[model samples]
Target: MASDMPNWFAILQAQSYSAGGTVPLQCETSATYIAKVIRKVQNQGYAFISPSHEATADFNDVVSRFFDDKVLSESCNSWVKMGPGRSRNLVWWPGTAHRMEISRDPRWEDFVFGRAKETRVNRVAYFGNGWTERERVGGVESITNYLKEAGKGDLATLHEAWNE
Candidate 1:
């Protein structure tokens, strides 16, 4: 079980792909798998836990480019919430949303024989990140109730139909 994150990730990816836009979630959120792992590799220069499947290659490829890119490796520490000394132009605090992109192409000439481009920090903004646990568990029921109370039954009906 300790070494199963990647495998779980592979299964989750497959499930998500099969199930369409909605993530295949149970108790924990999908962020625990995708976002956390990507953030970890971006900061540490390697995957915290590599997936045993071929999917590992995709995740590794992106992080490896980060290690090779000077800008990212040098500024990786500031993205986390440990302190205020992080890079001035970029930041991704803990328990909140964040994103980054590596522009290096491993299959191209510059990746191996030519000069590599600098990495750019991307910080994405997400809403409702600090909701309480009780609020989360009752999300669907509460939202449905709220919609009904607010005379938005049509929207709730549309949502239920879309989910089906």
Candidate 2:
């Protein structure tokens, strides 16, 4: 729903963050938000990487409105390929105590973006929706339960995205 593109706020809001922000307020609002949340996921023993569908669509629209594909293809870096067939529902890196790891490094961003990293395939874990996987694990429900046990189940953080 935002017309802004590529800016940090645009990126966040585009990714379905429903915080208190309008066009002018988005920058400051988003900055404050990022400050609070950065590296917070590491405390939970994992990092979250979800699609910014709105942002992506807005970016393409901007490109068409202001420029052309040649400029875009040349200036923009290659996008990470993410999907069910190529990758899994989740990409996980191990953390201390044999849990998931969340890093703030560029490589971590690449992984979050779902960029190809064949070498890490053996080192990292990918969970899909296979029957065997379901039998072995309880999917998101299990993870939510684990978070509650770990004292990381504060619903406020999740709900804070929506601007009341």
Candidate 3:
């Protein structure tokens, strides 16, 4: 266990501290806590990546000492990929707009249904125009037809269209 151990493992053992518990710190609960701590540290590192506002430079310096250059670079890239866009409404129009225009525009349902089908892999679908009994029924029927045509057989079929 000593001679064949990896450098990090040896370092961990040398620097290991007791938690005053009967069981070791490698227990499931302890492991989960450690994982949460690591994630928090990573998020903190990401928060300092591109200083949009004041105080970011100070925070970046604090996180840079613990995380290596490669790790920091990767963290910065991940943050950029996951961060919200500068424009909010430009990316995704609200569902209310779909409902309002569904009756007036013949192509509204087609556009909404098509996009929903496309997002099946990501498990995202738009279910607009379900305001009233008649509208809700129409919405359900349209979605059902769209799903059936898309070959989504395993999806739970909605029978009472208006109620839900």
**Candidate 2 worst ten-residue window by lDDT:** 88-97
Error of 1 at 65 (Å): 1.0
Clash count in backbone of candidate 2: 1
Candidate 1 Cα errors over 4 Å, as ranges:
1-52, 71-147, 151-164
RMSD values, in order shown? 19.1, 17.7, 22.7
Evaluate model 3: give its TM-score. Answer: 0.16
TM-score comparison, 2 vs 3, better candidate: 2
Clash totals, every prediction = 0, 1, 0
Query: Candidates ranked by TM-score, best first?
Result: 1, 2, 3
- The Cα error of candidate 3 at residue 45, in Å, is 5.1
For residues 72-150, write the lDDT of model 3, one tens digit per residue.
2343333222244321111111222332232222221111111223334443222233354454567657444534445
Q: What tens-digit string does per-residue lDDT give for candidate 1 at 14-132? A: 11221113333311344444545554444433323443434445544544453343443454555322334333222211111222122111122211111112212222111225564
Candidate 3 wrongly placed segments (more than 4 Å): 1-12, 17-19, 25-30, 45-164
lDDT (CA) per prediction: 0.34, 0.34, 0.30
lDDT of 2 by residue, 56-90 (tens): 45545543443233332233333321232222111
Task: Judging by lDDT, tell me the better candidate of 2 and 3.
Answer: 2
TM-score of each: 0.24, 0.21, 0.16
Could you tell which candidate, 1 or 3, scores higher by lDDT? 1
